[model samples]
Target: MMNFHFIWPLSGGLLIGLSAGLYLLLNGRIAGISGLTASALGWTSGGVSILGLGFIGGVLAGAAAVFALLGHAGLTITSSPILLVVGGLLVGFGTRLGSGCTSGHGVCGLARLSPRSMVATMTFMIVAAITVYVTRHLVGGF
Candidate 1:
């Protein structure tokens, strides 16, 4: 069976909504992954640390389950571990500089109608567009 479904965009949206709503109603915290992870890493808030780790674990587990069902055919690109690591590092750095990742700023922050989040989301969108353009045309690699 071909499972050509956008599960995360749908199910992940639901989970994010639930998390955000619960965070506000019960804890009064926004479900921003970068903020949560920063607090967790800095040990500033133990509660956020636990939630951040759980959120990350859930995301990874969900991705792994999807890949298992999808058979992991296009997981690799360019066949370079070093490039992949470098790319990951750059992404993390950008996320830090931007103060929130796509999920946080794009989904949670925007939903909460935060001006900071609005700008941050726009930055991500613009940066992503430039990245795709460079990757597809300028650099020309898969």
Candidate 2:
């Protein structure tokens, strides 16, 4: 039997919603992590550098706090380190190609009822399912 921690996902969704809502409300900007990270590179004194940094910092700090309190949620990764890096790079590339990520499209876009985001989100999910099936069941047995 698989054990599921429900509050973790719920809290994550709340934080994502809160972050996105707050950013839009305060700065009149859409809260996209990729865009924020990319723009942070060209960050000047003002113009959301602090805002972006604070939002991201809060996410990291929150994760650390959770781990510290929970004493490691006991998750493990089976993929090799190199494969993980390559997979991350590929996902980043795909996000750039698609103009957003699962979080941006699936969460915020779906919330706003965007047709384009709906298509993008569904396409990404289908592709992800196919990839996982092929990697784990097909090629994984080789």
- Estimate TM-scores for all models: 0.74, 0.85
Looking at candidate 2, the ten consecutive residues that score lowest on lDDT are 39-48
**Cα deviation of 114 in candidate 2 (Å)?**
0.9
Best model number under lDDT: 2
- Tell me model 1's lDDT, rounded to 2 decimals: 0.76
Pairs of residues at least 3 apart in sequence or in different chains that clash in candidate 1: none
User: How far out, in Å, is residue 57 in model 1?
Assistant: 2.9
Question: Distance from true position, residue 49, model 1, in Å?
Answer: 2.6
Clashing residue pairs for model 2: none
- Residue lDDT tens for model 2, 3-122: 678888898888899988877778876777776766665443455576667767877899899999999867888778888899899989988999988877887788889998999999
Give each model's whole-structure lDDT: 0.76, 0.81
Lowest lDDT 10-residue stretch of candidate 1:
39-48
Q: Please state the error at residue 58 of candidate 2 in Å.
A: 1.1
Error of 2 at 135 (Å): 0.5
